[model samples]
Target chain A: MANIHDVSKAAGVSVSTVSRVLNNHPYVKKEKVEAVKKAIIETGYIPNINAVNLKKGKTHLIGIVLPFLDVPYFSQLVQGISQAASVHQYKLVLYQTGYDEHQEKEALEMLKLKQIDSLIICSRKISLETVEHYQQYGSIVLFENGEDTPLSYTFIDHYACFMRALEYLYEHGHRKIGFSVNRLEGANSSQRERAYRDFLKLKGLPFHKDYIFKKCLNIEDGERILREIAAFQERPTAILATSDQVAAGIITSSSNYELKVPRDLAVIGFDDQPIARAMQITSVNIPLYSIGQILFEQAIAVEISHKEVSTELMERSTV
Target chain B: MANIHDVSKAAGVSVSTVSRVLNNHPYVKKEKVEAVKKAIIETGYIPNINAVNLKKGKTHLIGIVLPFLDVPYFSQLVQGISQAASVHQYKLVLYQTGYDEHQEKEALEMLKLKQIDSLIICSRKISLETVEHYQQYGSIVLFENGEDTPLSYTFIDHYACFMRALEYLYEHGHRKIGFSVNRLEGANSSQRERAYRDFLKLKGLPFHKDYIFKKCLNIEDGERILREIAAFQERPTAILATSDQVAAGIITSSSNYELKVPRDLAVIGFDDQPIARAMQITSVNIPLYSIGQILFEQAIAVEISHKEVSTELMERSTV
Candidate 1:
């Protein structure tokens, strides 16, 4: 088999020049690059990374399972993860499962098959048992609560966060409160729902099924929420938006629907993103970037651990 | 070496059952899953996907190199590409290079090493000449104009698009136009600058060096632009925002500076994203999603090709 030295000799270049060309390092002379390519073809030399990774039993690649990138929440998470991954000289393989069970399984399979060194599931649709079964293969970390499952996790207390926001709205004398959610079946959403029911039960407030708005993920969904509110004879005075984008949407389009923020309707948004700060919408500060860093560390850690991240209510206008 | 059949025989199960266990398919009986694991360990069975892929000379993984995933433009592009990639059963390995030349070279090296089947450069800081040399290793596609390069590209005409937008502002009886850009020395920015100079020369308008704003990408940059414009004793009557996020920021914060849109200053945005539609910003519609689909197709195509994607001017209340 032809080696790097053989290619270098054939190309009439130094071994370092051939190495630089093979690595695609910048500032290599065009003529030398061409010569290296010609020599490589002539010698039929192949550079196989898979073979190297197989021998070491480490690919230096982490698999990230996310649902969608267009959402600011997910994008922000990815941003944090990418920043952390780059700092450690690791690359990420994105499995955009779109909340599909089979797609999520493929990510787990990659871990079992040793295609990736570790798996970080930002969100998932697969059962806990199935995910736990693959723990013997490689390190796996979760972004949500992994209670009693023996898996490492970094989580925010969604129920506590929702309860605090709801209580704040109630203290202000706004009994009719509504909230928006994406994926009513999601683990986080289910926690928020449990908090909503418990809050209503404790406060002696009416349980209106109409108060919970589903499929509210982006800014455009705010307009839909307001339109629904406008048509209702009795509307909620305050609402919890799924994201800052949705909160900004409701406030920006408030006048079009003949409503005033905090007067006609108050809004509390999640993920105190830039838009929330720019628009002065009160939001819950979920440090997704810091969380992403913690998740990455957990994915590489030898011991199984769970980290509970805290949240803060960023009070601004609109509430 | 023990294979799937050998493990199945040891586990007292069918080969398909062992296969299902190896793939981590959901809904498998927990007892069978445990039995399969024990059998595999006892038999020293190894399921090497890399070895299988090495023989086929295909990894079924596409690499996407970009500067940032948090940006809406890149995320939306990734969204489209991911949808297309899923249809083709290809996973994506993301290289968040942050426009570092060395990091960009790493992606190219992965192609030469056959770690990724093809690469899609959504945005880059590396020279086109350096990138073109990697075509022999694998299919390389770009999201920018690859003029005179023997590479596949899907691009928007930034010069023509800028000129048309400048003309629209001129027809509206506004001169002394300004524009914002993410990177002043970027290829697209240079084209837009050339168009700006030509537009001003055609109309016999004077150019103000202070009129151009650099490092403007997100919504927060809008406030910075407005503050700078407000500080100017004599400001341009119109401006071209780099993105809808920047434009939304400008318009949303204009009232704080006591400046009204179109009355005090006319504004135009790029990429008619959802925020543009919600905020009614007149923007040049760059169909990034459709362009993403084309870029993915080019990445897998056998032949080299170049595609110039058309842009549309979406008129709204801003102009």
Candidate 2:
């Protein structure tokens, strides 16, 4: 309820003095600082942060655009970002796009409106031009999208990880193999699919279109894929899934059919998530947390120097 | 960078007239409105949202206090809240407590500092007194804690759900059952533990503490519990886990030992999450999305009337 003027009057000092105290500006006398503090306490003064942000031309807020907050992958990344942001005394404003182009556009408009100082886009449905249009307003960082223009990002080498898993499976004498992926439109999924195809071609093995299953991201999708696999006359000896949760589904589904893993059907998954470790479903552990750390660092750097950053990968046990 | 003065000058009107037009006041003349709009376009005058918030004495921002964003249960709840907040045109400022007391205190301080208009305590580690202190700034909504306070909330009946699961297992002719819980301190886990004890007492079965495994929230925890069970001289025929993910871990661990579900170890889990349904793990289904919906409704009601709300439960599979 109290404004700067009220604090100034109550402290018996000039408004400029109170302002300096609030901003922690140098050259304020200790006696005047004490007076301002007393006035702030007595008047129950809560500084208007929005006004402060406007005056400073920065909000100390970072916008995080992700597909969905409910997904474990995004949530984990958010956790890492949150930790890094907190360490830097910054706050996060979440924008859930649900992988919609319109929503992504609207979120970018918000960032352009100065509601946030910077943005960390986890994944987007809009074109690069749209993102570039808002680049003038604030720094933009990408996560797992692998865009190489006008922004910094952190991502895993999906192709290498997928190939490693496949190579390991092939070396282990598993000729019949299958894989389940999400939408083929995503950069990561597309890369994984490409690796699957290329590996089979290089190995001189027949690439059966029926062996590749798409549109399987969640548990139900995994179940559907397993059901399809069960109906196949020549079942694959090994299966590769996009996530550990999906792998759990396949393993559980196999149990219902009285098929044992490794003995009947070996399964490997990506994103060595906590659940994966718990289930011990051999998976390619991507450094998701580290990606978050790098993204956060790049965001800070971009905020300070207006430069771009890139991504790296960390290997783990799936293969 | 143009302000209200620029728009006013360009429109040949007083600053108050431009302010009225910007605020959507009903009294502005048609010609004046057109002139103001034209002036706004010509000068690229963007309204200062922070200044407007100051005048209205509200930020239109909500603070969400959560434990961890990486977990599926909490993340799904966040998704629901995010969608609801977006629809209502409110922004969320997230605070991750990681169940730490110091972090919770800092979050409370942020609430008092007016960073957010209202506070949503999703899963808190702070004491009741600390929560009561921050309630003075804005309405506080509890999610899943079920604390009997004046705070508005939406939570599931963990006791009833656990009882139902146990009762179903009893009717299925299972006497020897093992129970697994995440943590004994969490409010939800404590409620489930109490229900399990009561069920055993009602059935006149000796309550063996050894049969009750604590600290099993994730799959690894579930696997550890299974290993412990396997080492037991006399093992139970059935297992009741706090979550389906943990149940999956147990199943996976059991498979390694050549044990079967329903045949060697009948397994039941709480929170009929998607993975549970996909894996066909018998679980007491709690309508989490509905809970999220109800919580959002309560939050909106509290924001409007400055009053408190309560919780309700919805049933699904498992039990």
Candidate 3:
């Protein structure tokens, strides 16, 4: 196996100069650093980063823990976080927990084990109290919802966002409206549900728990939701979906059932994703990419206490 | 400030037992393992993983480099890779390069710097020759269109897949068919283009470069493609979109242009994602999730060989 000595000999540099370049020390000359890199490649040398980081007491790795990656919302967040972290020269290590508490615990273990420098929690099934204990290891930035006492967080105000969706449906002469969410008990879903109930009560319309659809995460879930909506005797005239995928599914499935959107059943979708824009589905535009960007920035910057990412309503033909 | 002594005392175990549990020694008692974990949480001890790995010479971190995470194809691949890596007890470090050569180079740097144990390049703008020299550092698995010497690669036969898509269009009695791709000169795109021209020649039809649409990555690009198709003085009767998002865009955009699928413009998309299933769009089923699973498995398996995944045609509503 080739070593630092071989790299130094091949590059015609001293052993210490090769060491400095491998350590990412900025004081080394650019050409010398380039030569060392080329020599290392030619010699096929491995630097033993574990040994280097042991001496330096640091690892430039940022851990991002979330439920899913295939979904549009989380993927957008991942993209934003990856870009922001890359700008800071930090790599992202993902922990896709998928509502499994054990996986979430393993991610926290990474922080405690010094396997990563900092952590960004996009969403967690674990309680804030459980995650708070690991704050001493590194900066843990929460996304979507968290208390501001011991850690920083970046999230949208979902209650207000849902209120806008509800208001838009009401203005279009739709009194009986339904909605969809990924989970019934998640922090964001509960907040939106609260908004749904309060808005209906303020307008003196009846709120039915049966009208809310849970366990809808993808387009398939959205398609299944249509059947449930159709089965309701006192069905809604319009629906506000928690995601664009769900709204898109309903619109596409509506054709199969001879149900035309707006003319037969008005629709409002969340996330204003590309599909939403392409289909002209009225939506609550949560800046998921910006939120992901802020999550990484705040986690790495380690300066802010808390921040709120705003969501706007994008009105289109669907409603 | 918590140390080994504190953990030992707190767990009511000897210092040696704590060390054994920390090292993941198999002979350690189960209850002692639980106690040590509990003490770890109680004392908030931050284990120096760098020091431990320095002696063992293993990081157990597998690097996964790709273009984008928000797109369906890449995200599905990410999900599969993450799941497969998690099962193997190896964590994935993602470098979402987004077509940036510098970022792609940074991923290669990680292997040389010993920051990652191995690398799985999902797709790259970097040449295979440039990546070939890094095989000595560790296993570097290429995702698509890689050589079968000194490195392992897992890829689908895009040439065959595109030919099937083209033949399907031709057999349906459509003489003219255009296609969309993310990049014009990509290894897979160029192969598909060659397949397009070859199939046209075999059928005694002239190939037109104007029928091809390049630089399409998302649904918005598909929407834009509709306008371009309309502007064509002699447009194709059908389209073979490279991705499901682009296909969704074309289908959705068709409504605005008063063009009906199959009747006016038959469309076929690649990647049988949830969006395709929801839209009932005919597509080429590339097992992206399985390919990602195989990428992680092969990169870690460390066998010196290459493999090819197969694709299928899903006939649905659009075609």
DockQ of each: 0.61, 0.58, 0.70
Candidate 3, superposed: residue stretches over 4 Å from native? A2-45, B1-45
Please list the residue runs of candidate 1 whose C-alpha ends up more than 4 Å from where it truly belongs after superposition. A1-44, B1-44
Per-residue lDDT of model 1, residues B125-214, tens digit only: 999889988888899998888877888898889999999999999999988889999998888998999999999899999999999999
Better of 2 and 3 by DockQ: 3
Residue A309 of model 2 has an lDDT of 29
TM-score of 1: 0.89
Q: What's the C-alpha lDDT at position B150 in model 1?
A: 85
Q: Between which residue pairs do clashes occur in model 2?
A: A278-B220, A283-A318, A284-A318, B283-B318
**Per-model TM against the reference:** 0.89, 0.83, 0.89
Candidate 2, residue B288: the lDDT equals 60
- For model 3, what is the alpha-carbon lDDT of residue A158? 88
Tens-digit lDDT string for candidate 1 (A117-223): 99999998899899999898899999999987889999999999999999999998899999999989999999999999999999999988899999998879988
Local accuracy of candidate 2 as per-residue lDDT tens digits, B210-318: 9888877777777888889888888888888877778878876787778887788888876667777766678776656656666666765644322222222223233
Model 1 chain B worst lDDT window (10 residues): B48-57
Q: Write the per-residue lDDT of candidate 2 for residues A1-319, one digit (tens) a residue.
A: 6788999999999998998999899999999999999999999888777778778768777888888887677888888899888788887888887788887887787777677788888877787878878887778887754455767766666787788888888887888999988777887888888999899899988888998888777777767877898888999998888777788778767777877887788888777787677656788776666677777777767443222223222223333
Which residue runs does candidate 2 get wrong by more than 4 Å?
A1-43, A145-147, A173-177, A204-208, A230-238, A255-266, A303-319, B1-48, B145-147, B172-178, B204-207, B233-237, B255-260, B263-265, B303-319
- Backbone clash pairs for candidate 1 read none
